[model samples]
Target: MTQAQTGLPDVNAVGLGAPFGWLAGGWRDFTKAVGPCLIYGALLVAASLGLTAALYHAGAIRVLFVVAAGFMLVAPILAMGLYQTGRMLERGERPRVGDILFVKSAIRQDLFILGFALFLVYSVWVEMAHLVYGLSTHKFHKTLPEFVHFMLADPEGHNMVMTGTIIGGIIAFLAFSLVVVSAPMLLNTKSNVFVATLTSLRTVATNFLPMLLWGIMIVALTVLGIVTGFVGLIVTFPVIGLASWRAYRDLVPSSEGDVAAAAG
Candidate 1:
């Protein structure tokens, strides 16, 4: 049976399995791959900071709520460019920094799907956070220091935080389940979106443990990026992007035969 029959995508088709030497290679490659993404990320940070500064200067911190709404409205569309850039790098091609400007043709439908999924995930996360806090309200009230301080100090509150975190994590996992393989699959093939999403969900369900570990590593690295004020994202984003392509290569079955059939 061909690799496609075995349900594995081509590892070498994208040149994604380069040895560690070529995978990250040096700071130069990292800079090349990540520079464009960093600039985009920086733009996002600047917009957010500008809004925050304007609100603070005006003594209207409450305006941050509207600013946050604007952020959510725009972030998913920007995320499409980020993922597409990663795909280009995975294929061992140099994407121009301005290539993201052609966002009109790239993954528009998938971005909408991803955004809706994220909304559901965030809603669930918020609900869980509120539930945990509500449960601990009495304890927080009776404790020394204020509610926020008490939550930070108590073991039970810590457990609540852990519970809320896990709940949010599960939602995120579910949201990604519908898209992880589908994103690349859609990029590579002319398959229908529903079929692509179904295939992706099946791929994740069948390959649960490794994908779960991959998800965990992504979260950890993202947190590290945030903690480091996004400077680390300059390296982490491209590395992880390349790594994701490799992971998808390892996970998804080859489609050579299908491609040949379609060409004919």
Candidate 2:
């Protein structure tokens, strides 16, 4: 019900099945430009694997789970390129791989502010994750084997997992509400971070059921990516990113039409 004072249109209320449409549109965009999309996905996969490997090598692999969770917190920024590709495709324009890199140049300030907000949120989640683990386990885990033992054999570890999941869920939900629409909206228009964020929250509030379903789908696919040795991300990440743009397209009204309606 909240309106954008800056003349942005009201949030569109989508059906429960709308997320699937977004996915289909995203798939089309991704496949139409497979080469560039794959490159983007591969970059993400490589970074994930590289960071995981570094953690394993450093004997701090137990912290890798937290690191993985942190990825979702900053995923909006990561998907900026895909949003660009989606917008380009929508406008019947072909996007090069380099377009993804240069897209941030236009909104450097807004992106920076959004990025800092995301980072701050992620930092809080990280600290909360640590606190959850500490409160639940009451001891340190030094290795993967130790971590596994604690989770499977220790009763306290079980409590930790439960508590962490609940807290992490709240954090993820808040992060989702904050940027689910704003990220793409930022790329598509000349709006400040606050306006975009407000629009995003409005979208989530107005379409809570569908947004919740979409959130569940995102998490399911992400888990699938991680389970497949991060190989699934080669497709999952880009598709999600592209699909997100479709989501934005549906949720936010077109600027031109909305402005015309306002004037008339």
Candidate 3:
């Protein structure tokens, strides 16, 4: 793979099942480093539970849906530890809980830039969700059951769901294209967020079908994690995180020679 004028290493084309292949690679890493990886996943589950409880107690039951979908926007950053675990494994080094938690490269400014950008996108998603929900219903449901009934029994809720899905999917896919490669690249390479994001965009643009399938699988698995009361996230999150690192490596240059040789 050659580094083009745009600074992106040539992206690889994979089969539609590439995402699953990544997940399988992730699972292998997870098993190899079960203790640290499971600990990391458990931490994510805790955070998920904490957020769901806080939102529920705050009587923002209407927003549970938003939170579930919006989780994708910030999940890349959250998956940093998983990426670290995968990276360490790739180097034939054993990873520990401490290594995953306090990764040295993760503290860089470029990652901060990416994180802030993700935060901005997440904020926009929240506001857009509010607007869509408000337009859909005048009444704010206070409980999960009430919200479920409103969505299932009312036409307004149905329209809102459809509209919100379309809008959210667009925003989420854009966010995914920006982060899917960049987040891991920033950690793995000396690249800045700009280059990282550009490469990420290029990867998706050049391989749209595979990228689309990857995005769908990510969202579907995330929804599955949320629906299972965050319990599923204990495994799903880590698997996705580890798998994401695999995806980044697959689509971009992993070694200095890979980029330099391509540049030549």
Q: Write the per-residue lDDT of candidate 3 for residues 1-264, one digit (tens) a residue.
A: 466554666677778888889989988988999999888888888988898899998998867778877888999988888888887888788999999998777898999999999889988999999999889988978888999998899999899889988999899999999999998877754577898898899999988999999999988888888889888888888889999999988887556743452233
* Cand. 1 TM to true fold: 0.68
Per-residue CA lDDT of candidate 1, range 1-264, in tens?
444574443322222233232234423444665667667666655665676677757754323323332233233334545556655654567767687546444546654675576566666655566677677555434322454465588777787667756765676677667666665555554555676667767777766765666566666765565457545555565555545544555566556643442233
Clash pairs detected, candidate 3: none
lDDT of 2 by residue, 1-264 (tens): 335445545889899999999989899899899999999889999999999999988987557888887787888889988988887787688889998756754467888888899898988898998887867855788888889899888999888888888998899999999999988877644567888898899899999999999998888888888889899988999999999999998998777743342233
Question: For each candidate, what is the lDDT?
Answer: 0.55, 0.84, 0.85
What is the lDDT, from 0 to 100, of the residue 135 in candidate 1?
77
Error of 1 at 77 (Å): 7.0
Clashing pairs in 2: none
Better of 1 and 3 by TM-score: 3
- Scanning candidate 1 in windows of ten residues, the lowest lDDT window is 12-21
Q: Rank the candidates by TM-score, best first.
A: 3, 2, 1
lDDT of 1 at 198: 70
TM-score of each: 0.68, 0.92, 0.93
Total backbone clashes of model 3?
Answer: 0
For candidate 3, the lDDT comes to 0.85
